[model samples]
Target: MSIPLAERIRPKSLDEIVGQSHLMGEGKPLRRIIESGTIPNLIFYGPSGVGKTTIARFIAENANMTMYKLNGTSASVADIKQIIAETEMIGGMNGILLYLDEIQYLNKKQQQSLLEYIENGKITLISSTTENPYFYVYNAIISRSTVFEFKPVTPEQISPAIKRAFDLMAQDIGTEVMLEEGVVEHIARGCGGDVRKSINTVELCVLSAENGAKGELLVKMDTVRELTQRSNMRYDREGDEHYDILSALQKSIRGSDENAAIHYAARLIEAGDIISLCRRLLVIASEDVGLAYPMAVVITKSCVDSALQLGLPEARIPLAEAVIMLATSPKSNSAYMAMNNALEDVKNNGPLDFPRHLQNKHFDGADAKVRGQHYLYPHDYPDHWVKQQYLPDALKDRVYYEYGENKTEQAAKAYWAKVKGDKNG
Candidate 1:
């Protein structure tokens, strides 16, 4: 029932803030902006527990504006209207700031609703989001606001905050609180630059420790390890960590490291990101495994089906099997590269015309020879293969797909060469 340690030690002033010296430090742009007493609509972009909301609160307090808070997830258009109405009642918005948390949760329609209010100076908006605001926030809102990126709080910055939490706890409980050697460092390093998490972890450890004879709580290293567990894996599906995990998984599979692939797959599974894993697996099967192992596509597709149907812990079985198959399969990016090269040409050239013989046959008399329909069927040839102009005139001699070192691709190259020779003869 007591206030959380994070809330109790929340920095009331910029000096009390432990990290983000880049912006909160002396003579920084943000510090100067605050001192000028002219707060603009702003965006604070960063990861969770990195003080995005705290900074917004600091701005509201320092600016001395009548501030209203809205959470983008639960608050609706009605809420915005209510805030506007309330602001109007309180002397028509001479100085007002609306602090919106998780602003990326609002859809374009909801974000668009704020433009008029923002333009008319009914309220100065301060928005916080874990996502890159440029991608998730409406462009209009982005254009009107100054964006400040908040980085992860370092271990040194968090250590002092952790010690402060202990001091506050001791004062509250009327007893001395002590930590075993290295426990603080363990937490500071393991928290991964999250001050709020470090504080909560220390609080949990303190609460779990047994009281001493003189009524002191002693948190030992084992208690710290037990309560804190291992280092928390930071993941936000809409944030940078999502792409990082995907990249790690793909590289592991491409490098034929089955163990690493499975490890990232497990991370995704634990994060409830099975769909992204399935999507990336399908791409890997076709892009990396290509003609070197055509069956890889079939295997991965089956795994995807099984995963979607089975789901969760049971689904991990097929997902893991597919990961191993893709990792162990011979790698080739020929198909992926070939398509990209061809697409680049198409995009740059603005859609070249197709060959006359290859044009779509839709008219009633489309097969007439006079209509340029003298196309030879491959079935009429010796090996059921024939050479014809399949590419446009400009790219007739262009070679998009190059054979890889795999036996299957080598055999394909040989078959194509033989077909060309027969046609020449």
Candidate 2:
């Protein structure tokens, strides 16, 4: 069988490559490197289907260099050595540009083996990975290579690419397929900047319509949505699914939906979003649970720290625990509102000067001036309650934290009320 449309139409030159104008545009760093004929050992880090491999090929072609491509997922250390040996044989004639895709999958040992060759300029190494290299790649290997981050193809770019692909296909088949208006835009949005997936979905729609004897292919929004849902896994790191999952997580916590929260947490963890999952849980504990269940915040923090230290699989346990704790805790937005209200007061009224009597007096003769002044130490008073103006003068009577009715906060409120009455009486 012939190659797929996406592969068959792969850009052979820089001019043919889509998107990535930031790097391929005139006077760009990558453009300069290619023009100078002195490409450095570099790592292309970014979201998938954004022309990482295509850009690498453009650079290799422009420089008139031989390209040696390898998938780090399937290749072993022995495979790397063999490629290197072959490159060295032709080293004196024309240099070889080694393109290692998914380089983050390489273990430390294999990564270490590539370091010498990269640094010594034996191979102009160009590696592409969808992961953050600092976390996944060996530090030694990272230090040896210049890193270029590629952004996902934006909707503006994807629209034109889809049109170009569709137009080309129509010309080849000798049939005019009228793409429904705004259909390309919908597909672009659904793809979340994944160019390959967008193009493939368009091809699928066209093929389906052709078989059905439809002269005009109406690629509806629903069709695009269904294609995205069916073909793509729903939790990509840099895709819309990431944001969707995050939103679900926050809503689940806010609504006190423990089951839903845990489900969202599982989805994030499965998609390798451990850090985001832990961070959101920590925020939920403090902002949503707060003093209503103070232990929730403590547990969440402990989980975050432990997850960072322990890393994956094992780390997932602590994250799961924190998610459960945050979800099940007494739900309250008191602390979140309190901070917001306090910040609003500050922004509107400006910084309030500290009361002269309450100001720090470390200098000589300053203590006497401050002593026996307006300041009242709440701890020293009966019931530990002295209702001095804690808020600034502009917000003196403003109340932000509405204590929740949970057992823990109710008790705290009662204790504070007794202390306030006793000290004032």
Candidate 3:
């Protein structure tokens, strides 16, 4: 069996590494640390394929230290103790680096076992995680180590690496290799800033491809597409990304950007989170497209019903239509704002009694004249409409439901003003 192209081309020295210029650039903190040959107890945090594990290997190799690698998913406290004991047997744990991948998978108890080894300097622990360490890693472990964040490798930085992979493939196959124009660009973009994924994609393409008439391995765009599926869509269905995408979708609709709104809706549809999509759309209808387009809420509900009946793949159609309708509709948040403001006042002031006239007359022994004192019956008046005190005495002057600026709201606002002789009534 041959070594994977990604492993074969892995950078042994920091100089050979591509991307992560922010940390690996000249005179950068990481460069300075690695060049000094003094590795620290550190955590490398970032997205996958951005060279976190590679960097750890480079650190251990560059420092001339004996390194032990462990997967946190499989490594138990006993395994860690055994590794530490091995280091102890080899003369008191100096110059020993332990690389633990997926460190966030280790529970608090498992994490606690590392603290003693780290505290005593028996082993330099360099952990890598794809999640935000501050949220996932143990506070004690994170506090003791320096954190280096690895950013996504940009297209320009990753392009040369793709070419390097081509050369490596040619060497491995003993033939000249050729790639169609834009193939490298396409892979780089599709890999979503993951260099490892891009390299593996290239390797897969070359391995699966047949030699051309001239015996040269020619990789075409379609071949690349067939080998490499769509770009990695970074989303955690129940994590921060869930709320983030929902916020983006709602904001895009509220901002009336149809393209952006539809794009975000597609993300939710792709994730198969129909319930979240429905909930967010309903909210957008009420909170964003309120009285300005009252029918939007009804349309969104209908779409939700259609999505439920149709289910995925086909469900995306109704979601897209709802996104487009909400995105293009006139927006007003007056009703939402009114409810929120009223809620705040109610919360602060405690419960207020209902108006005397509004109280149930069906209650046994309830008086209409004395207790309901001066309550006028609107049915006896012309137009069957009357302006009477609805708000509690304390909030009589408080205006919560001010009409928004839109044609529909303006018409309603005008009628209220005419009926009550006050615009805010």
- Mind sharing the TM-score for model 2? 0.62
Candidate with the larger TM-score of 1 and 2: 1
Residue 214 error for model 2, in Å? 7.8
lDDT of 3 by residue, 1-425 (tens): 17889888887677878888889989999989988998879999876788888888888878888889999879899989988887757544457899999898999999999999899888999999877789889999999999998877788889989989988888888988888899989888777677888988888888877789999888888988866664344322322125456788999999999999988888777767677788789989999999999999999999999998999889998888899999999999999999999999999999987677666564434444444345778888655667688789888889999899999999988886686664234
Per-prediction TM-score: 0.66, 0.62, 0.63
Q: How accurate is candidate 1 locally (lDDT)?
A: 0.84
Candidate 2 residue pairs in backbone clash = none
Clashes of 2: 0
lDDT (10s digit) by residue, model 2, range 1-425:
15667776677667667788888888888878878888888899877788988888878887788888999989898987887787657552477788999998888898888878777777888998877788888887788788887877778888877887788777767777776577788878777577888778778767665323556555555666677655455425433235556779989988878899889988777666687787677778888888788888777898899998998778888887888778777877777887898788788878886554466653446445544456678788666666766655566678877787788878988988787767667
Question: Backbone collision count in every prediction?
Answer: 0, 0, 0
The segments of candidate 3 whose C-alpha lies over 4 angstroms from its true place after superposition are 91-93, 230-259, 268-425
How close to the true structure is residue 95 of candidate 1, measured as C-alpha lDDT? 75
- For model 1, where is the 10-residue window of minimal lDDT? 233-242
